[model samples]
Target chain A: MLRRFGLVCVFVSFATLPAHAESVRITQDIEARTITLNGAEIVIDRIQDSENRLEGDFARTSRPCPPFCITPMTVAPGVVTLGELEVMDFLDASVAAGEGLLLDSRLPEFFAKGTIPGAINLPFATLDPANPYRDEILKALGATLTGSDWDFSEARQLAIFCNGPWCDQAPLAIRYLLQSGYPAEKLSYYRGGMQVWLQLGLSTHTPSGG
Target chain B: MSATARVTTTLNAPPDYLGGNMFLASSRRLPEISMLRALAIASLFAGITVALVLFKADPGAPPAAEGANVTRSSAGFDNLAITPTAAVPQVAQSVPQAGPRIQDQGHVASLPAVAADVDLQAMTRGVLAELGVTPPAPPPTDTGADDPLHAMSMAALSGLRKMTGQPDPAQSPSAFQTLIAQALQAGQSDAYIDALLNEAAGSGRITVPSALVTAEGRVDTHVILSTIVAQAAIASGQDIGAAKVSSSGRIQPGQQQVYTVSAGDSLGSIALRFYGDMSRYNTIFDANRTVLSSPDSLRVGQRLVIPTI
Candidate 1:
């Protein structure tokens, strides 16, 4: 009986030892058009052809997972113009790029007086905080996060302008877009705003009632 | 032969008593020895079981009191007293032994009240400092109320008068001179008045002339009158050349200089029309103070002094 009990104890200890180790699998199959992680897949459909190339450039700077698996993407440098760019340059680029312009001034009276033609007014106040677009902003813009209502996915290039040099509204709006993952190259700032236009003796049209 | 037979018979008869028989007898006793050994083992096992039962039944039984007094004297009583020594040795080694005893004993009696008194004094000083009042020295007295020379100074008195909208008597001449000069120099044509006032006011040096009055207690106003004539001439769309007074002391080009004041004509507007800047409107206000209670209350056809630069 003693010999039998000793044999049983040894068998139980051997059985308790681990049989297999756990691991994660990442697969990028060309046929799938998706990034598969442990059999779960996330699709990439709306990524543009040019943007795809840009993303590839971005991936060079980003850290890749071990065994050539997950590729973390970052914004490619040399896109956004730092400091100040001329308003005329911005306007010409915006028109050439076919991107819609957004004027962020909130004062309806001032907007009625005179503003950039074909520009839509979306005040920065209306943005919802829980939106993923805002979270993307913290990643792209770094520590400078002055939130605004400019969608990165909808518009390819967004030009924001306000009163003039004294105006901080457009810069703050641009910061929001840049932070929100809108490509800095696609963002334009019209620094010589309405005041400069008026001062240069350019034609200005007021709203019908104004 | 009989002795040999006797020995044989005795040997045959006593075979049971022989040493070989004794050896066989000892061999037969082995089973008995084994039984006795088993019985002794069984007895030891029973003793062990009994001892275990007693131990389990009364595990915490106290020691017997044999030689209790000797044990107490030797170690037990002394050890009981010395056990707390381990706890106290560190405190004794670390603390200063003197002076604190007196302070500890007196702490409740005198220390707290004295500390509270000092704190209250400091707080009072802070409050006084915040209130812009100097704190009183020891044995506090009300110094502010008792100060005899705390009355307002001449400069402060003048500031108070200005606040009250009453001009200081000493400064009356300068004020009067400035008012008269402004009234005399204000003009009528918008562009000219604006340009003139802009130049004059920007220059930062306006000369105030001495007051001159007429016999009937009216201000003798050669300067004011000429300024008005010149501005009116400009406003009437007639260029009155060089603004000269004839030898008879009458303004030349009288018809061209006189302006029929119209509706929507404010002293400032009129000044701007003639002086080019509205700041020279004060000239009109000073000139017409006797008739025009305020610049805003001007009547349509009221004659005004159109000051000249």
Candidate 2:
């Protein structure tokens, strides 16, 4: 009788093995799919629809040049332009790991429409040296104010993005951050922005009641 | 030796099926066969578990890049800079692929079983439904961000804002800016927006954006969302949404609006559509002066920034 029971148990175990290992992850326990701010939770993932395409103003390509010109592959020396997958890795390794921030360098109104998951809108305008609170923003980014000079030793890894490759708001911010002595290695530019992110149907967050 | 002979005798008496020594076959062979079967099952589970662990492993994940020199002494903070750490080779920034080209959503199949959201879980169904994942728990109240200082600064500032009833600012931020400041304090993700748009698109309940076609030649879902929300605001008699959507594509009325030049669109025509007067073509011409030689530089499908008259 015991043998029969053991045989039945073995069969049940064999039948149940289907590889649903949820706890297993490539990175930290955050699992690279979610971000939480204050008390709000933001789940990050690609749009389930493989057929999704870029739409709206981002899709329109005929903006006049000079201001809307295609940005160079690299914004400045030492700074790297990150693609979507690398951005995901950065989010996992740095942002989710709490050593980095995903900054949206566009204006507030554009950010209000919708933005990549886990992004905080810091608007390109504020990164300018002229802004009085710019120092406070830097302090928020992990730059310790030592007397008059800013110390960026422990500054947060900033992965900044704007509308798309055509829009230089992100590049502009990167230049300004460098001018303000933010380390080049600490910043990453997501060149695709809404143009590529939306085209691929990645998840986006819109602030509730905005 | 005698035990071996007895097993041979039992084998030689394989007339068990023929009703000769059936008991012998059951007595000796049963335990060995069952034991081997149990071993095989255990091996199977072990093999599968190892394969799964390897499959989900982040093989592409490189070690976290450390700064080359920890002692970052700028012109200003020469005195207080910390001592330098051992210089490490900084990793070169890798160029990302041009195409995120609609590949299989294979990664979605591996979504951590820990995440909890009834709606998202339902959406995640069918990809790996057979692999029994636990039902998602309730959304977490807190997942402490890794950047303790960033979180702390935000907390401290917002707390102070709450106490003083005003942010200690030389320039007061706009209402939109205030929303942004408050947004960072909370926790969240935006899959809800995508799901909501899908629901709205599926039911034919939402209006489409006036832009005939987007860069991808598909309808703009986000713009559609913006238009709907803006219309809802207008229905409350805000008199908004008439003039311009910024270059980034919010259906807003403000100083800067983007007008896509149609086939017959001269600067004057675009000016007429945006403003009440036709002579205000120069408003657009002047705003885009960096690209336009004269007012005649307009081309079909070119996006012109129409500034307010």
Per DockQ, the best of the predicted structures is 2
The residue ranges of model 2 lying beyond 4 angstroms of the native Cα positions read A1-32, A35-41, B1-309
In order, the Cα lDDT scores of the candidates are 0.34, 0.47
What is candidate 1's lDDT per residue for B255-303, written digit by digit as tens?
2233344433444334434433232454555556676553444454567
Query: What range of 10 consecutive residues in model 1 chain B has the weakest lDDT sum?
Result: B110-119
Cα lDDT tens digits for candidate 2, A37-85: 4345666655544445666787797999977999988999999889987
Candidate 2 lDDT over residue span B83-197, tens digit each: 0110000000000110211221222222222111011111212111211212122111122322333333333334323322333331233222222122211111111222332
Task: Highest lDDT: give the candidate number.
Answer: 2
> Candidate 1 chain A: minimum summed lDDT over ten consecutive residues — where?
A20-29
The DockQ values of the predictions, listed in order, are 0.00, 0.01
Q: Model 1 in CAPRI terms: which quality?
A: incorrect
The 10-residue segment with the lowest total lDDT in model 2 chain B: B86-95
